[model samples]
Target: MASNEVVVDGEVVHCIGCGAAVQTIDKNMIGYTPESALKKGLENGEVYCQRCFRLRHYNEIAPVSLSDDDFLKLLTKIASTDSLIVYVVDIFDVNGSMIPGLHRFVGDNPVLLVGNKLDVLPASLKKNKVKDWLRQRANAAGIRPIDVELISAKTNFDIDRLLDQIEKYRKGKDVYVVGVTNVGKSTLINSIVRQSTGIKELITTSRFPGTTLDRIDIPLDDGKLLVDTPGIIQPEQMAHHLVGKELKLVTPQKTIKPKVYQLNPEQTLFFGGVARFDYNSGDKKHGFTVYAENNLYIHRTKLVNADAFYASHVGNLLTPPSEENKTNFPPLEMHEFKTTRKSDVVIEGLGWVTVPADVVVSGWAPKGVSVLIRPAMI
Candidate 1:
């Protein structure tokens, strides 16, 4: 059974190497390998497997990998073009989603900020506040977006509006979609393809950044193209450090329920066994509400056992980076926040802690996980 793999339709697919269900994007587990390699073998007059075929033909661009110079070169094309730029951002990790000099990259081109994953937030949150927060985040990144729209790439929420908006701003020109990795850019584009073109066959998708290293063009009405550009992976992201299965545990699926905790000074909240938040100094016994994946364990423990607990349980209880993560999780870092306005202190992809007004608190998480304060979403 050495050649158990098969060519399915036009793509070469294999039983996911990691033994997980063969999801095309699950890089850690089995089926997620590229299909282009298989395609190469088939074209050579050989019976190639499905995964390799996908890695070959459909993903003719090869594995979504490029040197920094290649990246800058590819991005320069977008920068020099007159196409409309659709910059996608994950609402939960706005700080991490930001491209510091995006304005310079897009150059005089109009940028439309698409805040994705809104379906993960609690139902009680205000949308206006979230929109305002996204506007501010784009401004901070040096991109003056004409409009900001929130959508859920997973659920296809507001995507039609996004398309309509693109059509409106694009003025019959091409539309270029761009974002850093793991912001669901592929998923969103796939959704758009299904709706616009009825093409459901899987294209290049991966949990890892650089999955779509090359620009893909999908035809639009009026001969315009909806181009999908590769997302850049930031070094400081927790997602970059995690294994596929561990990453599945951290990424949010369903809507998030903001878990409110009433805590006295000096108490610690452990997010699963991975990260710890110690309320070092706070007024009115800090009321902290955390929003994260429901499966991730959030525990209130003594500050003393925090380190030992993490050491004893990481990869077992705290899990993420799973057993397959190559890079060791960095040591935890602490950040102190004084809230003049009621805000959410976000732990990048993990979740957010909604701090009640007049509460002074300090939060801690893994070193690269960004802790940002924004107007409460819930």
Candidate 2:
């Protein structure tokens, strides 16, 4: 059968289950269903991709890889289309979560920046402050979002407000929701579905051309679509280096409790074997507060002893290279920064340490992972 031809009805159409195009070949590709499944779905008067077939029948998400070509196709479609872009980012790892070069691809579409995992931050942090930070970060990445929203998808906080904002800004056009993996984009959509019609299951009954990417199309009452683009995987995250329990251990689940440490120059703190912070120079003693998952272990030692300590203790005393994964873990690379004002030394995918103005610090992370300074978040 031809790639575009529907074996079922002799007409070209997408999966009624998830809107992906149906293909009888290449199970690795999007919109692929077994010949048997296709016959069954067509006999039932609807065609479903195996991805959605499994989702509907077994409640299993059989993930399909959205290839680079597929992603570029999605981006090109978005650029040519008139829609509201709902770009989601993780507040904890904002810098790592942005889709590279998205601003250029967005064309005339107005972007609404939605920062997820806001509940992971301290309650003392203001929402406006978070939005400002998110805007600054987005702007730095060449995205000037028309508006910014901070919400905790995990807690369902501000989801309704976010939906309202989307409804208002979309203005009867389609809405394209985009994000990197782990930003909780799917969870946010689930919440929206639950609130909109109390339908717990998201059945994509609409039809569009098989775009090659497994884009979920949610029909709007306005005869438009709310497109959920597949999440892109970023390799720069420290998350790429971890597995099993360590990833979960480093990921914050709720409100972060700040841990304050009285510090002087020439002191070093180890954030497991994953990251390190050194108080290299300072005018006086300052208290640095750590904002990371409560479960991650932090070890402090004199800077002079730090080298020898890490050399011996890493992967043992310092973990999450955890011992088994140590050899494969990249060597720690140093990134030094001097704070002109209160700033955060952030280790991407780990967390951050907030320090007072005028402190010279050095952050270390596994090579290729990001460690940088930003204005303090809280």
Candidate 3:
């Protein structure tokens, strides 16, 4: 089936289900499912998938959600109880994964920061730095986690240790796993269940955000419940802006390579069709490697033509919105970063560039695309 065109901010966004092109009109079909559940056994063809059905029926909430505020409110309700908080974050997109002001609502609750997607980063990155990054991020979010650990929800990496930590901090209290969308909260839960109990009963997982609209509980031996909460989609994230297919491409499938290329001052490097980088003011020549999708195109140009080059050839040569985002894309901003400790200058959902010790560099990506420094994981 083909999708119908719906204009959003003068652009076309696809239907999450059926892949038929969609427009924002006519809630009867493609882009309009209720944000909460509908009555069960209502006579209708299979309009939504089993996931949506489960969300509507079980949770009574169609969780194709909005921003963090809604999610925070949901968390506040959960926090009203004495539950342990498992704050899941994407190790790959750490900055983008955080929910701002999360700590304020989680008062007096023990929080565990579980960094998902360690499998996505290069193995050479230091785990200590990764933990430090999580700590710093947690602090910035006003969260004070009792424990921080890295695990790959897909590969089951360090998941046992994570489970042990959960058991310890939870102290027989219910566990609530929360994160903004696409942070792999569902995958981590599934991995935990399989590892601890070996039960593979299906739980919700999706490439897009807001998959778990309501909480589902899994029993633990300690009289505690590991509850899966819906992932809130942050509007500022690049994931929310991308089409589903494009999102899958940008999502990391394996360990990343810190691909370093040497560039002179005023040289430019393009990251796929998503972002661009220029060595505005550095040493005569600086060596840098971008860690992103292998298929993404990286082209180097003189600094002067960089802006014009991007304006003319963003989706054409540099591409993710494929052809759609050529002019509609957000403006680019340059962020100057000076690294004293080794770090990865992350562009959130985009990719990151590894900087060696004592190196000073400037980075650029689309506006609203976050650029931050963290201790190098590789």
Residue 90 lDDT (model 1): 85
All models, RMSD in angstroms: 7.1, 4.8, 8.6
lDDT of 1 at 71: 58
* lDDT scores in order: 0.70, 0.79, 0.70
Q: What tens digits encode model 3's per-residue C-alpha lDDT throughout 1-378?
A: 334454446654332222223333345442453423221212331234334444444633233324556556666777577988999888777778888768665668888898988887777778887788789878977888888999988988998889888877887799888888889888888788788778552465667667655456667786767777767667667776666466766777777666779888778787766766656665466677789866666788898897788778867676776786556767778888777777777888877887666556667766787887766666
What is the Å distance of residue 261 in model 3 from its true position?
A: 0.8
Off by over 4 Å in 2: 1-66, 201-213
Global lDDT of model 2: 0.79
Residue ranges of candidate 3 with Cα displaced over 4 Å: 1-70, 325-328, 338-343, 356-360, 374-378
Backbone Cα, N, C clashes tallied per candidate: 25, 0, 17
TM-score of 3: 0.79
Query: lDDT per residue, candidate 1, 296-347, as tens digits?
Result: 7777866667667767766666666465452477777888887778887778
Q: Please give the lDDT score at residue 247 for candidate 1.
A: 67
Q: For candidate 3, give the lDDT.
A: 0.70
Work out the TM-score per prediction. Answer: 0.81, 0.83, 0.79
Best by TM-score: 2
lDDT of 1 at 245: 62
Per-residue lDDT tens digits of candidate 2, residues 33-117? 7889777866776677877766556545554665566666766678888999999888888877988989666788999999988
